[model samples]
Target: MKLLALQGFLLIIAVEMVAVLVHQQHIMLWAAGVAVAVPLAGLRRLLTTGDAGSADGVPIIDEPGAALRQWLSGTEARIRWSESTRADWDRRWRPTLAGRFEVSSGQGRVKDPAAFAATGVMLFGDALWPWVDPGNVAPAGEDGPGPGRAVLEEILRRLEQR
Candidate 1:
């Protein structure tokens, strides 16, 4: 919105400048045409490139953990935090040091633990980190959606924050 306003201001200034500097009628007309054309291009770009979050419906998980698990299955992992967590990553989550994100795999490490765990939280939420431990921030209650869908929404919110 700010960008569009700035472009409008600039277009007004340019049109004024062109009208003042270009005395001949033909040159002035050409300049005006170019000025309008430039701003139209900018407007087109602004309208086309919009926020991806403004979609119509909420992002629902049809198959619960299975979809995310399958996505992770194809992911490449450089390190495995635990064989157990890796084994149950789909149904029940056990946090580990390393995790493979949606597309790229094996990129996370001990230093950047979020690289792997962030996606896991999005996929499994409370299952990934039980209430018994600390640093658990999963959503509460069953008001809006089921556990799987709620976790999926949480994941989307987390991704948008990034």
Candidate 2:
């Protein structure tokens, strides 16, 4: 910008000098104004226009991972909410975890209910089976704290292994 301003200043000086010599001391305010206006307009455009090749701005490349981020955010919220209350554990965390565990013994998809339970038990063990059993939802009026972060983290770790 400094270089551009310098060049513009030189341009204006050259134009004014030419006008003086050609017009014989007869000042053409209109011609001087034109010269001044051109550079100022260019400067304004340079100031406003973004660079085509610059990498200084925030990137616009988040689109591809936007859905993943959204899902992770929602899941994180659910985890926090579920950990906050027993109702949320049964309503949100358990159901989601159970839903996430619907796989066959071989880690393939499973549709049968018995097979789902068996697979879940095999993967998460008898202790965790109730917590992530699709057929289970805590009875109403069951309100207290759920398994906290440590348990949740363990469940997630176990789940991720498969």
Candidate 3:
């Protein structure tokens, strides 16, 4: 605002000086009117039109990009997880699975380790409970091969259904 005021004032002074030399002092009034009105008019248009590329006001999100990126990242991680060993599952995926079960439980609150274990048991039932049991955070007794892709897919399906 200070700069705009200075510019308008300077324009008025210049116009007035030129007007005096040309013996037409009325030109100063025209200069002052143009300086004030032109800026205000531009401001009005700018405010009403909003973003240049999106004249409707709000900017749009790339939903497909976001969804696809997330899916790809998760798929890539799951591929690695499937290729890992029992010890790796205990170290990595177990906590993630336990967290999901706990969050999906009726309590909807962060809880103690015991509560997380109970939630995992209840959600996964007997068959898969061993996979994500919170009490099973200790290193696996064996570095045996992981259950692989089909098992992981079944686990995902079961989780989604639950």
**TM-score per model over all chains:** 0.27, 0.49, 0.47
The model with the greatest lDDT is 2
| lDDT per residue (tens digit) for residues 40-94 in model 3 | 6655665686534444656555676899899999879867886788877777787
Runs of candidate 1 exceeding 4 Å displacement: 51-162
Among these predictions, the greatest TM-score belongs to 2
lDDT of 2 at 18: 88
Q: List the residue pairs that clash in candidate 3.
A: none
Say which prediction, candidate 1 or candidate 3, comes out ahead on TM-score. 3
How far in Å is the alpha carbon of 146 misplaced in model 1?
29
lDDT of each: 0.46, 0.74, 0.68
User: lDDT by residue for model 1 over 87-142, one digit each (tens)?
Assistant: 33332331221222333334343545565456545544556333211234234432
